[model samples]
Target: MNRSFPPLFLFLLLIGCARNSEPTTVATETADDDWWKESIVYQIYPRSFQDTDGDGIGDLNGIIERLDYIESLGVTAVWLNPIYSSPNDDNGYDISDYRNIMTDFGTMADFDRMLAGMHERDIKLIMDVVVNHSSDEHEWFVQSKSSRDNPYRDYYHWWPAEKGDPPYRYSLFDAEGNAWKYDSTTDAYYLHYFSQKQPDLNWSNPKLRQEVYDIMTFWAEKGVDGFRLDAFQFAAKDTTYPEFPGLTDTTFIDYYAMQDGLHDYLREMNEQIFSKYGVMSVAEGAGRNFEDAHALVDADRQELNMAYAFDGVDVPKYGGYALTTMKEVFSRWDAEFAEDGWLSIFLSNHDQARMVSRWGNDSPEFRAPSTKLLNTFLLSMRGTPYAYYGDEIGMTNIDFDEIEDYQDIAARNGYTKARAQGKDMEQFMRELNFLSRDNGRTPMQWTEGPQAGFTTGTPWLPVNDNHAQINVAAQEDDPNSILNHFRQMTRLRQDHPVLVHGSYELLLPDHEELYAYTREWEGVRMLVVMNFSDEGVTVDLPELENAEVVIDNYESLSRTGSSADLNPWQAVILSL
Candidate 1:
C-alpha cells in the first residue's frame, strides 16, 4: 500500500458540480454514421500489458491470452501500441521493418491470432502506425546513406555537406536537442525530429508516401480495424528549411506541426488506403488550433476519423495547471466539433504520465474515489474515450528517486541534457519524477504476488510498488472498488446513446471546486456532477421531475431539490 503521488501537478483545481440554463458551449448530434463514434478504445502498451514468454516483455500471444480481460472491461476496441520489428531504440517507435513484428513481441502469426481473438470477443483492433520516422538501422535508411547517388536517397531528408549546415530544427528526444545528424559516409546531414537513431521519413517524396500507403494496406488486409498514427502531424515538413528567429524561446510544435501540404497527404492516404478498407484513423497529435483539428477529421475532409488533440494532456506540467484552463480547453474543443468531425477524449496515454497522479488526488485516503471520478469524466465525455490499460485500477506514478530507474529515452536523454547545461540535478529529477513517461509505462498489476503477476521473469519496466493495494484481483470482487466503478461506467456508456451523440453543456464553468455538465439527446437528458476536492461541497443541481440515479461512484446520493450536497470526490449520473 505504498501510495505516494507526485507533486501536485494537474487537476490542482479539477472541483463541485452545478448546471446553467443557457449553454456556454455548442451542442449538436455528432454521430455521423460511423462505428468508431460509439467505441470505447482501450489502449494497451504492449511492452507493459502481459508476458507469456519468460522474456520479461509483453507480446502478441500474451494479448491473445488476456482477450477476456479486455472484453470484461466492456471496451469495444483495443488500440495496441507498436509491436512492429524494431531495434528497441525508442521501445518500438523507431521501426526497422514495417511488415514484421518485433522479436520480443513475437511473430506475424502471433499477431494474426491475437487479432482474431479480439474479433472473436467482439473487440476491434487498432494498430499503432509509426510512419513518421524509421530506425536508422532500417533497410531503407541503411541503403540511403550507402552513397549520395543511391536510388533510396530521397526516402529521407538530407542536406549535403557541400551546402552549409542545415537550418536549425528541434528534436523531441535527442540529448543535444539537435534535429540534424551528420553521416560520415554520405557527408550529409539527415533530419530527425526524435532520437538520432530515428531518421525522419520524407513524406514529400511520392515514392516514399506510396510505400507507406502499401504498408498500411498490408495491415488493413490482415483485418486490423483502425490505425493510430504516431507523431504524424510532423510527417509533412517544410523542406525549404527556413530559419526562425526565436526558435528555442517558442514552443517547437508551432513551427513543426500542421505544415503546408499535410492535408493533401492525409486526403491521399485516406483515398488510397483508409477509404478502400474502411478502417478508422486517428493521429497522435492534433495541430495548434481548432481549424487544424477540424481539417484533419471533418466528415467532408476525407482524412481521419478522430482528432486526438493533446491540449488536455499537455496542460499539466511543472508545478500545476489552472482548473479553469482544463475546463476551458475541453469545453472549447467540444464547441468546435459539436456539429461535425470527432475527438478522442482521454487524460493519459502511453506517452503521458498516470491519470490520477497527474490529474486527480492520488493520496491513499482519496485515491479510489478520485480515480473513479476521473474515469467517470472520461467515460461520459462527448467523444470516443481512450482508456490507457492501468488507469482503470488507479495506478499512480512510480516517482523513481534516481535517473537510473528510468528507461524511456526521453527521460534519460533529458537528464544528460540538463546536466550538460549545468542545471540543478535535484530540481531536474523532481520534475522528471512527476512528468516522465515511465510513470505510465509500469507493468499492469494483476495480483499481489511478486512482479504483480505480470511475468515470472523481471518486468521490462519495474512494476509499481503500490500494486499490492491497487490491483485487478484485489478490486475484482469489491462492488465499490475503482475497478468496478470503471466497469459500471463503461457499461452505462455502451448501453446509452445519449453519452455518445448527446449535446454536451458545461455547468458552472467558473466554479473553483465543482465540475458539472449535462448530456442531452433525443428524449433523454442526464446530469453529471463531480466533486474534485478533498472537502464536502454543495452545488445547486437542475430541477427535473422523476429523477433516478443512473450510476454514481459513491454508495449514496445526498441532496434536496436544487441544492445537492456532495461528499469529497463523489461523482454521480442522474437521468431526468
Candidate 2:
C-alpha cells in the first residue's frame, strides 16, 4: 500500500481535478448553439405510429424501422408522445415511472436503438416529459397515499375537509362533485385535475422538485436531446387555494392552475436541469394568454425556448361559426409574441382532430386543394412548424360507427357528456366524429394492407377506411402528392431565410377568403398569396410588381404582371 498508486489512477485523478477547476461555460450547455430553434418538428404518437410486434401498438423498434421515412420528409426533429411506463389513463400523459420504457412500447434497449438511428440520420429526438402529475399507480404516489405522516406524503397535494364544507367540493368534477378522491387505506383526499387516476404533484415541496429534476437529468444523461413539457403551465398552483370570487355567487369558478411563481420554477428548472444537458425545452401552455406566454419564453427570462400556442389554431365550431377568422387569428399571433419569443405553430396534435378534416375539406374532390392551402398558410408563417404523423399524406379522421370503436378517455367522456346533455344524437355523433382524439390517434396509414401496415393484427384504434387510397406507399411514388408537397415546403423553408425567423406583415387584412402575407428577412422579401375559397379571385399585388414566381400550387402561374389571378383554392410563393 505504501508503494503508491498506479500512474494511470493518478493521471485520472489529476484530470478530474482539472475539470473541476475549469470554468463552466453556460453557452455550451444551451441548445441555442444548435439549429433546432429554426427546425421543423414532426410529432409522432408512438402507439399509433407503427407496430413491430403485431400487438396493435407502436413500439420503439417500429420507429427505428421508419427512421428513413421520417428523415425523407425533411423534418429536423421528431417530438415523440410519451413512451414511458404508464397505465394509459390519459394516453401516456400519466406517468407511472419516468425512467422505464412502457412494456407495451418496448424495452429500454429498443429506445436506445431508436435514438441512435435518429442521431445517425442527423435528426434530433425530443421526448415528451409529463411532470405536471403522475399516475395514481406510481410508487411515489402510492407511498404518499400510504399515511398522512409518511415522509412522501407531501409529494402530492393532499387536503383535509373544511368545517361544514363538503369534502367532495373540488374543481374539474361534474355532478359527481370534487376532483379529489378519498383513499380508504390512507384516509385522506388526493387532488387531481384531469382524471381521478392522475394525481397532481405538489411542487411546493423542495424534495419533490429535486426528485423531478433528478429524473430529467437521468434522461438527459441517457442521450435525450430535448423535451416537450406536457401541461407545463399547470406545474405550480396557489398554495392558499383561495376560492374564485364568483364561486360563492355562481357555479362557474374561474380557477387557473398557472398561478404566480410558476415562471420562477420553470426558469430554475431550465437553468439547473435542461441547460446543463443542452436540451431544448418547449412548454405546453394550452390556455395561457399572450402576456404569460411572452414572459414564459422571453429570451431574457430563460424559462422556456418556445411554447405551443393554441389560440390561433383552435377554431371554434359553435353556431356554424368557424371561431376566429384566419386573418384575426394569425394577425394576433403575429403581433403578440413574434418579437419576444418563439411560437410553436401546429395544425394538429394527438389531442386534436385531423387538420385535413377539421380545417381542410375531407371529401375526395376538395381534399387536395384544402390540404395544400392549409400547408401553405402554416409553413409560410413566421415560426417553427409542427406536423402530426400522417399529415404529410393528407390523412383524414377515422369514422367510428359505435362508441366501442373509440379507446381514448377524452373521446368516450365527450360522447357520454354529449348524450347526458340531451344533445341531438346525430349532431353529437357528428361532433364526436369531428373532434375526438381518435380522429388523430388512428394508426398511421402506411400501406394498403391489413391494419394499414401499421400493425399485423388489428390496430389499437381502427385505421381509416381510406388508407388504401391515401397510404404512404402510394403517395411516395407520386411527386405531386401531398407528402411531396410537404417535403418541398420544408425544403423551401430550409433554403429561404425569410420563411424562418422573419418579420410577418399581413396583406389584404380584411379579405375573408384570401390570406396573403409578406415575410421580410435581412433585405430578402417574399410574399405568400393564398385563396381560402373554392372560387377563383383576382387580387391586386402592386407591391409585388417586380416579384417572380418561386412556388405555386398549380404549374401555370402569371409572373410578368403586377396583379395576378388565382385559381380556385390556389396558393403561390413569390420573391423579388
Candidate 3:
C-alpha cells in the first residue's frame, strides 16, 4: 500500500473524526457576533497558485481544483489577490475594468463557479479592491486623456503640462523624481505615485467615487464576503498639490497616503456601500501614523473593519524582526485597539518576502520547525491572522541570478534606478533576492514532476529548484509535515477562544531568542512560547497549578518544574 494512501479503515476513521470535530459552537460568546474576528484568512496570489489548460498561468479553474486543499487547511476565508481585468502592469493591481475578470484568469462564469465552490465548502471569499489607481489602459483613463475637457478628465489627477511638472511632488515609486507623466494627447500630466502606467484615481470626483461604490456593490451583491482595499491610503490625496518646503530629495513616500480627507472618504464609502451591503472591508494603511491606523478601523468611525500595519513587514531588520520590536509593535496595536478597533495580523503577503525566509530559519534542517514557530505566533495572536499562500508549507525565497529573471515592475524599476544611481548592481541584486515581491510570486510547488506539477507547460515564473524535495505531495503524506503542522495550528486557533479574543500580555519581551506571550480571556489563560533562534533556550515559565501542554511543534515537552528547556525553533502552547 502507498504511504500517501491511508488504509480504508484509517481513512474512514479520519473522516469520522473530521465530521465530529466540525465547529458547532463559538469559542467565546463575543465571537458569535462577527465571524471574521475569529476566522483565519488565507491570501492567494492567483497568478502563482496553480495552472490549468497548459496556459502556464494560474487561473480560476486551477483554484477551483485546489479548493479541497485550501479547505483542508481549515482557513475560513480566502483573500484572493486582485483578479480584476488588468494589463498585468502591477500583477493585477492596475485594474483595466471593474466588472470584468482578467482574460488570463478566466471569464465571469469561471469566477462564479469558483465562488460557488468556496461557498459550498463553508468558506468566505474576499476580493481585492484596487480603487487607489487604475491601469492607464482603462477606458476611463483613455477618455480622461483624450482631451482636457473630456468630462472624464476629472476621473484622475491632471495638471497642465504648461505649468512645468506641477510643482514637484513625491512618489513612493517612480524614482525619477516626478510623480506626473506627460500625456501628449491631453497635453497634461496625470499623477501616478506608482509606475506611470498606473494613474492615481481622483477620489475628489463625486462621479468617480460613485462608480467605485457601484463596483463594490456589484461584487458584494454577487456574494463576495469582503474586500481588501489595495493601497487604500492613496485613495484620497492632497488636491492642493503643494510643493515641499526647500526639499532636496524628491522621493515621494510620505506625502501621498493618509491625506486629511481620507477618513471622510472612508466614512462616505462605508455609508454608501459597505454598510449598505453589510460586508467587511480591510484597507492597506501605508504611511499611516499609529493614530490613523486606529482611526481607520475604529468601530465608531464607520470606515473599514480592519487595516494592515506595516511595522512588521516594513521593519528595517535584514533578518527577522527584533523581539523587542515585535513585542512593541503588537503590544502597542493591542493597546490601541483594545476597546474598539480591529487589525489584520500578518507577517507576509503577496508583496512581501516569505516570512520563514525573512523571520525564521529557512535552511533544510530548521525550515519546518521555524515555520511552525512563526505560524504559532501568528495564529495565537489577538487579532485575526492572515496566512499567505505557500507560507504554510514553508516556502522560501527564490534567488534569481539575472534581473530579467524577475517579473515585478517594482523590482525592475528599482534595479534600473539603482544602476543609474551608480549603486553596485551585484549588491542591489543581492537585496532583491531577499526583498523582492517576486520572491513570493513563484509558482506553487505541488509535486516532484516537471514544473512542480503547477503546469504542463512553462510557468510564468520559474518554480524553485528545491521544489522536488519541498513540494506538497511529499509533505501531505508525512503526519509531522509543515503542512500538517499548519493544519493543526489552524484548527487550534479555531477551537480556542483565548487565541482569538483574549487579552495579550508580552512575557520576557527582552529575551533575545524567545518570543513569549500570554493570552487570557474569561478566566482562561494560555501561554505561547516560541524560540526564534536555532539554539536551545531555557526559560522560567510562570507557575500555574494544573498547567498542561496543549500543543507543541515537537511531540515531547522538556520541563523541569517552572523552568523549561526548549529545543531549537521549538514552539509550545500551555493551557493554564
Candidate 4:
C-alpha cells in the first residue's frame, strides 16, 4: 500500500490566495520575472533517480511515475541534469546533440510523458543546457575536424601554436600542457577547457552564438519551462589568446571567456528569446563571487534569474579528508549573498559527495540527528532549496574496493593521478572513495528491496550498502524521519512567503554553535534557530520574547520563559 500525507490543509490555506489570485500589475520584461524565482526546485540526477525500464538507469518514464513523490515535497519545479544524447563522457556533460534525448535515458516519447506528468501536477521542468562546449563527436565538431576549409571549422576555437611558444593552457591537464590538441585530419589545434573530448565552442563566431540561441528556442518551444545553463562563464574566450602569467617556461593562454561583451550577448538572448517564452534561466558559475552573483540574478541585469553559488558548499577539505564545521561554512554564506540577488542553496549534487557521509556523521548512531540538523540548516536559509535524490533518506557514500568499480571520469582520473604519484593504493582509494562524485551518484534508495527499489536490474552505479536500513519505505511512516522533516520544512516555506523571499538577518553572528537568523518581510517576523553542536546549549532570547514557537525539531518546546534551551542538534522556528 502506498503511504504519504497530503500537506496539512492549514498550510495550503496560507498559500492558496497568493497562488490562486491573479496579479494586479504586469511586471517589466526581464529574465528575473520568470515564475522560477517563486518556485522550490528539486534537483534530480536522472541516472540515479529511478529506473522504470529495468535497464539499470533512471529514465524519463521513471520520473513520470514518481511525480507524486516530488509533489509531496511541495516543490514546484524540477531541475534535471542533462538527458540529452551524449557519449557519457563527464556523465552527459559532453552533449553530442542539442535536440535528442539519449537512448539510454529513453526516447523522446518518454521525455514528453515526463513533462506531461509534471505539468499535470503543476510542476515545471528545467533542463540542463551545456553551451560552453559540445562533445568532440558532435556533428559540428566532426565536420570542423574533417578539414580546415569545412564551414564548421570556425564553429570551435582554433589557434596555431607560435613557433617558439607552448600551446594554450587547458584547466583539465597538469604540468602546463597545451589546451589545444592537433588533429591529423585537420592539421589544426582545437581548444578544450575541460576534457579534450569536449571541444569549446567559439562564441566569437556569430553563427555559433546564434546556433545556441536557436537551440534554446527549440527547447523552449517544446514546452520546457527553462534551462539551467552549464559552464555559462566559459562560453567565450579571448580572441587574441594572450599568454597568462605565473606558469614558468610555458605559454599559458588566459581564456577571457567571461569578458565585457558577454553580458550583451546574454542580454540579447534573454530579451529576444527567453523573455518571449517567459522561460527561467539559471547559469552555473562555479567560480563566481558575490559581485558576479548579483549581476547574474539582479532584476535589472536581464542575464539570468539566478546562478548556483558554491561559496560555502566548496569549503576547503578539512584535515585534507573530513568536512569542516557547518558553522564556518554557513556563516560565510550568510554574509556573502545576503544583500540583493538570490542564491540556489544546496548541500549535495550529482557532482559532489553526499552530505550525510561528507559532512554529517553517517554511522547509525549519529545519522538520524545529523541528517535532521543539516536539513534544518539548509532549508531555513534564504534561497531556493535543491534537494538531491536520496538526501532526504540520509544516504551514505559508496564504498568500492576497486578503482574499476567507479564510473565518474573525474574520480577515475584522480585515482590514476594518485597511482602515478606512487601513493598507497589503499589510503588513496579510501580518500577517493569518500570524495568522489560516485558518492552522490549512487542510485536512490526507494525501499528495502532488491536494487533498493530503484531498478529491477543491477544499477549502472552501485547502490549504497545500507539501503535496507535507510530506504524511503522505512521512513515513510515515521513522522520524525528525515523525509518527513523535509516535507515539513518545505511546507513551512510554502506557507510563509517571508521564509521564501524575505530579507535575511544573521542574529548573534558570532555564536559558534548556533546558526540563528531572522527572515523579516513587511511587519511579519520569523526566526530560525539551529544548534549545530553535539552538546546541549542555552542562549538568551530577549529579542524573541514576543515570538511564539511555530515549529520545533522535538515534540515539546520550552515556552515558560523568555530564553530558549535547546537539546543537542535541535532546531526551531518561532514567529512574531
Candidate 5:
C-alpha cells in the first residue's frame, strides 16, 4: 500500500489584478493556471548551441536542427540568448536592432521557421530581451550621438560635458573606468553600467519606454511565448546623476539599478505589452534582495512572472559556501513567494562556470554522480529550473591554459584589472580558468571528430579536449549515462505533481557533508538526500524505512533496514 505524508506548509501566491498607481483596467487574458509553475526551462547560448551553416557560429537553423534533441530532454520552454543583430563585442548582448535577426544567425524568415518548428513540437520559445542597453552601432544610438538637438537624444542617458565628469558611477564590466562614456561629437557622456559599446537606455524618456514596449509586442505578436530580460535590474537609472555615497557598508560605486520607482517602470511595461499578450516573463534579478524580488514578480504587481537571483550561480569568491546556503536560498523564497511572486533555480548559465565543475566534484570518478546530485536538487525544488546547454552530459569546465584561449569580454577585462592590481599572472590565470564565463561559452561537443562534430570548419572557441570521451553521441545509447539520467529525472518531474507544487523542508541542515530535504504536497511526501563530499554517508529515516526508491544516481539503492548507505557523491529520491 502507498504511504501518505501530511502537508507541512499550506501557502499559495495570491493572484491579483494588474497594478498601477493610476486608474486602469487590467488585461483580460490572464491564465487560470500558472503554466510556469510546472515548466522546465533550457537556456541556449546561440553562438555555441549548434552551427548548421558551418560559419564557425551557431545560427537559428542550427537550433531548429536540434529541436528534437531539446524536446528529448522533456523541456517545455527554451530561453535563447540574444540573437538580434550585434557587433559581437559581448557575444550578442549588445543589440544593434531589436526587430531583425542577426545576419550571421540567419534572416528574419529563418526565425519564423524556427519558431514554427518549436511550436510544432509543443516547445515554447522565450527570446532574450536586452533593453537595459543597446549596441553602440544601433541606429538609435548612432542618431542620438550625432547632434545635441537630435530627437533620439533622450533615448539614452547623456550628461553635458560642460558639467564636468558625471558622478562616480559603477561599471560591472569595465572595472577601471566610469560607467559614463564620453562622446566627442555630441560633447556629452552617456551612461553604460556595462561595456561602453553597450549604452543604457533612458527609462525616464516616455518615448524610449514605448519603443521597448513596441519591440516586445512585435515579438509577442509573432508567437514568442515569453522573454528573459537580460540585465533587467539595470534598466532604470537615477537620471539625477547623484554622487555615489562611499559608505563603509556600501563599498562599490553604484548610482544606478538600485534606484527607486524601478517597479513603476516594470508595471508600465507589463500593462503595455506583457500582460496584454498573457506571456511569461523573467528578469535577471542581480543585486536584489528577497523583498525586492517579491516586489518585481508578485502577481499583484503585474510585473514579471519570475526572475533569476544569482545567489546559486554566483558562488562566493573566498569559497566554502555550505549546502545550508542553498537551503536558505530556496526556503526563503518559498516563504516570501508564499502569497505572491516566483523564483527560478539554476546552477549554470552562459555567464557562469559549469554546474558540476563549480558546485559538484568534476573529477572523472565523481563527475556523473555529482552531476545527477545537482540535477536532483534542481528539479525537485519548488520553482522553475533551468538547464544550461551541455550540462546534461556532465560536461566539465575546460582549463583554457592561457588568456589567449578565452573569448569572453568579461574575462579579458578581468585579466586587465588583475594585472594592474599587481596580482600574480599565473595565479590569476588559474582563477580565470575556474571562474571565467568563457568556461561555459565553449563550443558544444556533439560527437568525437576533428572538431567534436560541432562544425566542419574551425570552431569560434576551442572545444574541450575531453569531448572525445564525453560527447552526446557516446551517452545517447547508454541507459546508465548522465544524459539518460537527466532524461529520467526530467520525466519524473513531469510525472510527479509533488515536484512541481510541493512545499520544501530542509533536513539535516547542519550536516557537513550531507544535504537532505523533504517535499510534501497534500498528503504525499518525497525525500531527497544528497552527499556533497566524496565520502560515504549512512543515514536512517524511519519514515522512509519502507518507502519506494523512485530515483537513484547509481541506478540502484542499497537499503538495509531503516538505514541506507549512500556511496561517494550519491543522491537518492524516496517516495513515502
Candidate 6:
C-alpha cells in the first residue's frame, strides 16, 4: 500500500464538483452513530486541578466543585488522569489497586459522585486505564514476586537468576536505564519498562489479561464513557526476549511500541468489554506508521476507536520546531486516516509541558493571542480535539533552574542518569527546564489569591507565578481574552458540523510562519488561517474573495477582497 500525498487544496482551490447544500460527512465510510468522534475532550491532570483537602492534593470532591467551570468551556467530555490507588512513585500511573481511588484523591463514593456530576452535566468522563504496568505494591505483583510457585507468578514477566541476565530492555523512567530489576526474594529478575517500582505486566498470560478487562468493565459498569489506555501500545511483548539489533542508536519505541500480539488482546478486550457496554477505547499511541496505526484502529479490526498518535504533540522541542514541520506531520496523518481510521488531535496533556510555552509564544504580550491561535488550530482540525485544562487560559511553563525543584520522576531520574553518565549537565538541564512533565502538572490558576485559588493549603506543585495575571476569573468577562476565545472556538466548532466532519485542505503548505487551511462540508466552505509565529504576515488565499468573517482572535481585522493582514499570532475563521 505505497501511497503519496501531494498537498491538499481540495476545498480551498479545487472544490471540483460534489458541491451541494445537503450536509454530509466527507468520507464515504463512517460509523452509524459517532458521539466520541464529535467530542471535545478536555484532559484534566487531577493532581493539580484543585485541592479541597489540606493534604495539598487535588481530589474528586475538588473536581466535583469545578464541574460548572468545565461545562462552561462547551466541552463534551473530560479525560481525567489516573486516580487509582498508587504508591506515588510515578504519581498515579503506578497503580496498586485498580478498583479503589487514591487516598489522596478520595474514596470510591467520591468517584461515584464525580461520575454522576459529569453525567448530569451531559459531559462524558474518560478514565485513564494504566494496564501496561502496575506498582510493585499491587497485590498481584506482591504475590507474584513472593515465590516462584505463587499462583500469580505468571502475571508478571520474570527471569530466573540462572539465566544470568534478561535481555537489556530500555526503561523510560528508571534511575539506571535497565528494564530488568533483580528480586532477591524470588531469585528472579522482573521486567519494568519504567521505574523499578513499576513492573510491566505479562500481557501474553491469559489470566493477567482477564484481570485488566475485569478492571475496565468495573469502571464501565460504573458509567465511565471511555478509556485512554496509558502506555498500552507497549503492552504486548515477546516472552522469549529476542535481541533487537542496532538498538543503541535507534529509539526504543520502534522495538517496544505495538508489539506483535497487541491487536489480538485489544480485539478480545473489545469483544468482551467494550462491545458489551459501548465503551470507547483510544490507546496511547498509533504505533510506528500508517500500517501499524490502521491495524490498531481501521474499524474492521474491532480493536480501538481512535489512534491517539504522538506525532503532532512530539513536534515541539527545546530548540524550536518549524510551523511547516507541524503542518506536514498533522496534514500527512490527516490524509492517511482520511478514509478509514480516526485520530486524536492534541498538542499538550498530562505527559507534556504547557502548550503555550512549547507550541505558542508565552511571552507576556503575545501569550493570549498565541494561545487563542493554537486553540483555533485545534478546534478547526478534522479529528477529535483534546484540550488540556490550563491551555484555555494560556498557561506557561515553570522552567525550574535545579532538578531539586522538579517532582516528575522522569526529570529526577533523567538528571540522575545525566550526572552518572557524565553527560553535558548544563544542556540536559536546559532540555529538562523546557520539556519537564512537571510544567504541565503545576496547580491550575483559578483566581488571584493564595495558591492561585487552587487550594487553601500548600499545593502539590508550586503554582506558576504568572497565575496572578493569567487566570479563569480574570478572563471570564473579557470576550477577547484567551479563555473566552477558547470558549468561542468550541462553540463555533459545535455549531458548524463542517469543522468536525469536513475535508481539510492545506493551503500554503510550505509557509514557515503560518498554517492556513480550509474545511468544507456539503456546499459550506470555511477558510481558517492562523499566523503561528510572532510576525505580521499577509496571506493571499484568493479563496477568501467574498469571505465574511465568522470569528477571530483579534477584535478587528485588516482585510481586502481576497487577502488579510494577520497581526502576530492572529487567527480567523471566514465563511466563503
Candidate 1 lands at a TM-score of 0.95
Residue 452 lDDT in model 3? 92
Worst 10 residues of 1 by lDDT: 9-18
Candidate 2 wrongly placed segments (more than 4 Å): 1-34, 161-177, 245-254, 316-324, 419-422, 558-560
Model 4: worst 10 consecutive residues (lDDT sum): 9-18
Which pairs of residues collide in model 2? none
Candidate 6: worst 10 consecutive residues by lDDT?
8-17
Better of 2 and 3 by TM-score: 3
Any runs in candidate 6 off by more than 4 Å, and if so which?
1-25, 28-33, 246-250
- Pitting candidate 1 against candidate 5, the one with the higher TM-score is 1
Candidate 2 residue-pair clash tally: 0
Cα lDDT tens digits, model 1, 398-500, are 9699888999898899899889989999988988898888999999999999999889998989998899998999999999999889999999998898888
Cα lDDT, all candidates = 0.85, 0.74, 0.80, 0.72, 0.78, 0.85
Candidate 3, 220-310: lDDT as tens digits: 9999988888877767877888776422222233555578888888899999888888777888753446566667887788988886776
What TM-score quantifies how close candidate 6 is to the native fold? 0.95
lDDT of 5 by residue, 1-576 (tens): 011111100111111222212111122222554787678998899888888887888899899889999999999899999999999899999999999999989999999999999999888888999998999999999999999999999999999999888887766677474678888997899988788899998888989989999999999999999888887776777778767753211233133444676788889988887888878888875344656677788778788898677654543342345666555555555655544567798878887777788778788898889898989888887789999999998888888887788888877876787788799998777667777787788888899887788887888988889899888999999998889889999999999877877766767666777778777776778998888878888888775688888999996778887888889888899998
Candidate 2 lDDT over residue span 1-576, tens digit each: 011100110000000000111111111121454466578899999999989999899988999999999999999999999998999887898899999999999999998899989999989899898887899999999899888888999999887544223233343322232556767675567777657888989888889988999999988998888888886676787766655432210122124445777877887899887778889888775334566666877788877878677655554342232312546676666666555677788887887778877776668876776787778777887777888998888898777778778787755655665577677988666666666777888889999987889998878878889988889998898887888888889899889867876677777767766778787776778889987666778888786698887878777665446887887668889886
Name the candidate, 3 or 4, with the larger TM-score value: 3
| Weakest 10 consecutive residues of candidate 3 by summed lDDT | 9-18
| Candidate 5 root-mean-square deviation in Å | 7.3
All candidates: TM-score: 0.95, 0.90, 0.93, 0.88, 0.92, 0.95
lDDT score, residue 147, model 2? Answer: 84
What does the lDDT read for residue 312 in candidate 2? Answer: 55
